[model samples]
Target: MSGNRSQVIIQSKRPPLSSAAPVKVTTPSSVNYHFTRQCNYKCGFCFHTAITSFVLPIEEAKRGLRLLKEAGMKKINFSGGEPFLQQKGAFLGELVQYCKQELQLPSVSIVSNGSMIKEAWFQKYGEFVDILAISCDSFDEQTNQTIGRAQRGKSHVENLYKIQSWCKKYRVAFKINSVINTFNVHEDMTENITGLNPVRWKVFQCLLIEGENTGENSLREAEKFVITDQEFQDFLDRHQSIKCLVPESNQKMRFLDCRAGRKDPSKSILDVGVQEAIKFSGFDEKMFFKRGGKYVWSKADMKLSW
Candidate 1:
């Protein structure tokens, strides 16, 4: 296995297809590959802030993705500190292109903050990505800033609209991931959420990992973002009018068989292989699919022109 390193390249063209064939997995329906935990935002409630570094080399990442593809993994969502934080989004685009064109993975998607994305990236690699899940915690600017999701000089809410428009133009399924924290738990986002018209709205109860987002090693102990279950429910009740709402409570998120809740030290498939890596993380297929992980909009399920 190659050493983990960062490669910052502006991709004028896609990388050549690796002759190495894909290794398939038959058990899991989908996998959330937190490929890079290097994020631009310092949101206090972030669960995956355990690592602040990008470790896997591009070749290693591609190999691991191919392995997952061969493993019969139907869908894969690339998450990060921020997936689009790389140069010209070239690093992320290369991986997406490989999944769609080489491995031929049915669904290849990204979870981003929507602050750093550009129209040029969508125009170039839009066809490769099936969905773009953006994180927007609140419709209120002050509330967003207080939650540490505020972009300098740029409006996060405004960026949401811009990205939504780009998604419509590029034919990528748009989704919103909002963590209902104490900061914005009561902020009524119904008007803004409804107007945006996301294909899915994933609302998460603010979560805390033992040492990742809490304890000594964390970037910022996220006690401030913590909200009670009743508070979370109240927030949900306020937005019940939204068309596509998917709620995941903290109990369901942390205690139940949830795929995205586990905060074990993430390892590359190069080190542990795909199965052991997933098994080590406790990814539950039932919970994953139950949360609409294998939706039709994913995996090349384009409703618009590619």
Candidate 2:
């Protein structure tokens, strides 16, 4: 599935931005929040499990929304195991509408795989949303089949094209994101994607996190999908016309740069187990630990007190 499918929210309420905000989002900045761990595609470069698990209960989400509204947060980004897959998306859509009409919070956005975003999903929330990020790694049919999204019948390339076309018909702006691994690291791939249309292209560098980043893991049947540096560089050179939207606040949106996970066990959030690690975002990032193979937030990882 798509990695970093986490939705980030604006910390304050303001007029909707017709264009992106000043690129440089700095520390103490709250940009994205992971909504659910459930996803359809298992991409090479992913970090969903490291951030969240299960869906945020509807009641809990309501409370979260109340908090956001009180805090004056206007814009909220929706993401998921295909955000449209949520059991009762209308509630989420309603939340967006509340922000748009009642609170007049600028705009809401959703990032999805676009497998089958039925008319109901968009009709109910499209007006409230600013954009829909459709994941399109490559325009190659073989590549889509190899990437494990083949069972969906239609080629990933065809689905992506349809999404772009529909967005145009609906008068919505869309962006395209791709994660790079050692497998598809060859040139001419991204170039092919850019050659078609002037879409926003996002390239993610593969990270060595959880399970296996290098060696081999039985879980990852598509290990050959890793993209190489030279291939990536050549494609970037060829597609100079494409817009690269690397967020200033997050270079690695889905994958955290945990280089320490390589040499030391304590450096990685996943390595320390969900139970014993520190928890961030209202909880201590280090307080997460594993119990019965489940990662749960146990205690707060409090820093030294003055």
Candidate 3:
């Protein structure tokens, strides 16, 4: 989509696609464990099939926390249909607070659809999160409504600007996340978002996951927004500070990986770590570090990092 005459997107040349194929190897992931499903937005990008609504039981999460620490994972992120939906929105604030104060995890992040966000939630628990990735596909209200974010007030641009104000006030990491497809491909991306927030924008290539209510159809509409792998690398280079990582799989896609080298044949670094943390909520933070193993990013292409 060409932007209004002389827009940066129109003037900017897109990069080419890379030859890298999705490889299959299991290595310890540096950004380790994620919380169970629990989100509010019926996001087109979620693999949960528009269903993020549940925190892992306390017993389960405690063990999961321990395993994550042992693996030497640098960051722990919380994502769900809407992670804030734990205990029906009321507990959202408490969940985040506990994650930071009690778990004491070094780095924690949350990806929200932002349709159900409340002002008070941010003012109170803003510090609990290290990064807040908000899903904002376009500036057009009609376009956003088509993609299932009807709850947002007025227009996408308005809500985004207001949300940015909150982020700035809290001094929290505020990233603008989007899965570009046809509907939003034409909007003024670099202009609309970059004008206000610099180096915090993230553009994601839409994944073709089946089963989700608005996945394939949305992707089809946003097809023009589809940039090949090389184009993505170029986009990141052009917008150097945005901190983008385009997985070959695109989203939390499931693929066959048998080389994780778990000590127990059935155990995976992700599985063992999350499971161990959930085992003992009573365990001390120090003990979790000792028992939870290092998270190994065992990729089909690269050897173990830790």
Candidate 4:
């Protein structure tokens, strides 16, 4: 493989797809692809923990994305361990360009810890990415450290501001995702969040996922981060004045329902195609729409002045 653009491809062995037709076909209007399960941050309450370091070959990944686009996928959110960590953001930049320029998808976005993103990455891939959702659990520096969101020699808050500025400079819609836990549930982030002025501020309640954050197979012990539903609601009530605030708790927001306490591994879309693989995704289509999953996702139609 080429050195300049190729990522470390650790392919997972999979069984062959069945020839039988699927009973139902789920139109994947929006999908999240956790391309790599490796991250630099040690966030205690992360549901999608670093269980494996495997990332499919760049060509195969692009092929899978093409399949999704052909299968009615409108929006594709590239998430990680950290999407930028692979090949120092080159891997992600290529995928973003493919989804927007080649596939002509309406929306291509990424969810990342702001630390790894640099101004140069934005310069190259900013136009392709509709939204950049940075994970910021707390405004307080000390609180962030307690939540394992702090990097050793860097200030998470400062990096957040720098990224916010870059987003504005590049005309990318900036967004924030905060997981309200015991560390930040009582803290009022009204002033800081409002000052940043994100197009959307997604406030999520700390959730537990078996084999990821909870149970025996988990990498992180997130029980300490858990809070009651009432606490989450109180936090929302406090931030009610923030017009862009979008609150999502365990009950209301989930692309896939793993309430059964164990998530069964499903075949890769590359192996079974998007139609068969999506059936086992446990995606809740109704709840996805109810929680305002769909909106003006395309940056082209957003009509924002750069």
Candidate 5:
């Protein structure tokens, strides 16, 4: 989880609005689309686990992107159990290209495990991508394996470096996302993170969603991964030298009220329209901005030397 995670009770029924009262509108400014829930890595604290193998057809997915762009969406982030899992990254590449090329969104990005990405995928879709955030929870090989963040034989850290190099070669701004959990809370990542020198290092506190990781219907048991706030803070203090660090606390991530013990399904934007579908999202625009969610996200505007 790259961002903060929090749980809140959402009122299932609200009083009817007066005919004269204006309907509440939530802008689709920066949207994280969990297009697919299937991932290769079995991270113990993964809130969005593989519950289904379904992926929306490419053309239909594009149609929804167009609707979001029309509804004032500036950034479109493609996330998943693993986005690159579909068609060996072609599905994600197409969406990234469409959002940047056709829809002309300011920012198009993906959050992936970094193991499935190959040079070929970036070769075709690199130019259109603004950012690529890779999830790397620990630099220690054994710790990563214990946390289920590693493939049987491949080194997750080495793969991370290879992906970082690809990001630089492709001119895509690189970012690192680490979920601080009990296993790697004490590991000093200062040396490794400084060596990578990503544009941003997003440090997230391990979070548990009701039906995703903790409740009866959950797929993963995340209680073992949970760390105290003080532990998370100590880890942050240790990495004070990393200038690009961005910390996200579980409490600060309350923009969305994930009530129903899981992410409640709403009518597809393709069928009901972006405006109608987004109302059910319960997005707090003010809190999003307050959390430093907006920044210089466009690659062209970043002015970095490729």
Candidate 6:
């Protein structure tokens, strides 16, 4: 639900940052592995099929995770309907612990809808995680309800702040992922997102999948949410003052292989090896790395003293 909420242009008297020491680029970048499809919210524009099912067993899931590391993926982001929705993140924590402690992946992260996350869970496993990305589409409650992201009687914005504080306390880099669609494309989130100051604000255009979110047999209630590329850009233009803005139009989003069933079909790491699966899926390797898909922005790696 997070859009590139804001952008800040810092005008300084000092020299430009390009004069600083060169950054070491991590090779064999990252991949988004949709470990589960069980999510709480039923957003109309969502392209991922919402399922009340769990596929891989714990041990088998871990084996697949290790295979992904062996395939040269430095960062493995666990995504789903919501990664934190399972048993108060018990099963999710085990996977996170395994990736960081056993497989030793450089970056381990998750994309979640912040409602089910607890402070206790963060205290136990937060150190092992690199980033916690919350999907927050709108700051307005009515808009959220219209978009199907309401947290029952609770407020999503409130949960976001609480989660942000928890992330700060546990030293996990916080990120925001927003999908811009018709409902929220015109909303200005500068004041709210600027206050949060997340490390990254990933904004994506709303997309329609052939059989998943659209078409005759699909859950296509999201046609009302689709926005044109120009309209999406207009929204970004309105929030140019917010920092850490990374905008992805539908064209760019299509090239990201991790987005299940986008341009190429999704393949499970358990079914085929990571390399073979990515190869078969036609993931844009060079583009993926170039888009800052993998960076040394992990709070554990940076040790920011906030």
TM-score per prediction, in order, is 0.85, 0.64, 0.60, 0.91, 0.91, 0.85
Regions of candidate 1 where Cα sits further than 4 Å from its true position: 1-26, 255-262, 299-306
lDDT score for residue 35 of model 6:
59
Residue-by-residue lDDT tens digits, candidate 2, 1-306: 112322332222123344567542212112233466566676544544333345655655545544554444444566655566666566557655765676555545567777757666666676666556777666676776665544456777767777776665554555676665454545455455554342345565544444434434323433355445565565556656555443211222222433433211222122332223212222212211111111110111111121
Lowest summed lDDT window (length 10), candidate 6 = 1-10
lDDT of 1 by residue, 1-306 (tens): 111332111001112345583553325446666666678787887766735475577887788767766655666777777887766589999989988899877777789998889999998999899889999998888888988897778799999999999998888888999999888887898888888888889999988776568777776688888988899999889888886899988755653322343354435456766565554454444455455554575634445443
Per residue, candidate 3 scores C-alpha lDDT tens digits across 1-306 of 001110000001112335673532221233323344444455444444323223455555545445544444345555555655565445546555665687665555667766666778777888776667777877777887777655756565676777777766775666677766556544555566655562245566565433332334332223333556565455445545433322232422222111221110223324434333223222123322332222221121222121
The lDDT of model 1 is 0.73
Distance (Å) between predicted and true CA of 216, model 6? 1.5
Error of 5 at 195 (Å): 0.7
- Candidate 3 achieves a global lDDT of 0.47
* Candidate 5 RMSD computed on C-alpha atoms after optimal superposition onto the true structure: 5.2
Show model 2 residue runs off by greater than 4 Å: 1-30, 49-53, 69-74, 88-92, 187-199, 211-231, 244-255, 258-306
**Model 5 clash tally?**
0
**What lDDT does model 2 reach?**
0.48
lDDT tens readout by residue for model 5, 144-169: 99999989999999999999999999
lDDT of 1 at 96: 90
**Which 10-residue window in model 1 sums to the lowest lDDT?**
6-15
Clashing pairs in 5: none
Q: List the global CA lDDT of all models.
A: 0.73, 0.48, 0.47, 0.81, 0.81, 0.73
Per-residue error for 256 in candidate 1, Å, reads: 9.0
Give the per-residue lDDT digits (tens) of candidate 4, residues 1-306: 101211211111122346685444567777777788789999999877776677878898899888878878888888878888999999999999999999999998899998889999999999899999999998889999999998987899999999999999998999999999999999989889989999899998888878779998789999999999999999999999999998889887544444475455555666666666655666666677677787888878888777
What's the CA RMSD for each of the models? 7.3, 12.7, 14.0, 5.9, 5.2, 8.6
lDDT of 6 by residue, 1-306 (tens): 001110001111111246464642222356565656677888888776653365466787777667656656567787876777767799889989998899888888888988899899998899899999999999999889888887679899999999999999988999999999988999999998899998889998998777668777675457889998899999999989877888877777655433455333535545655544444454554555455555674566675776
| Backbone clashes counted, model 2 | 34
Model 1 clash pairs?
23-70, 24-70, 24-71, 25-70, 25-71, 25-72, 38-81, 39-81, 106-299, 107-299
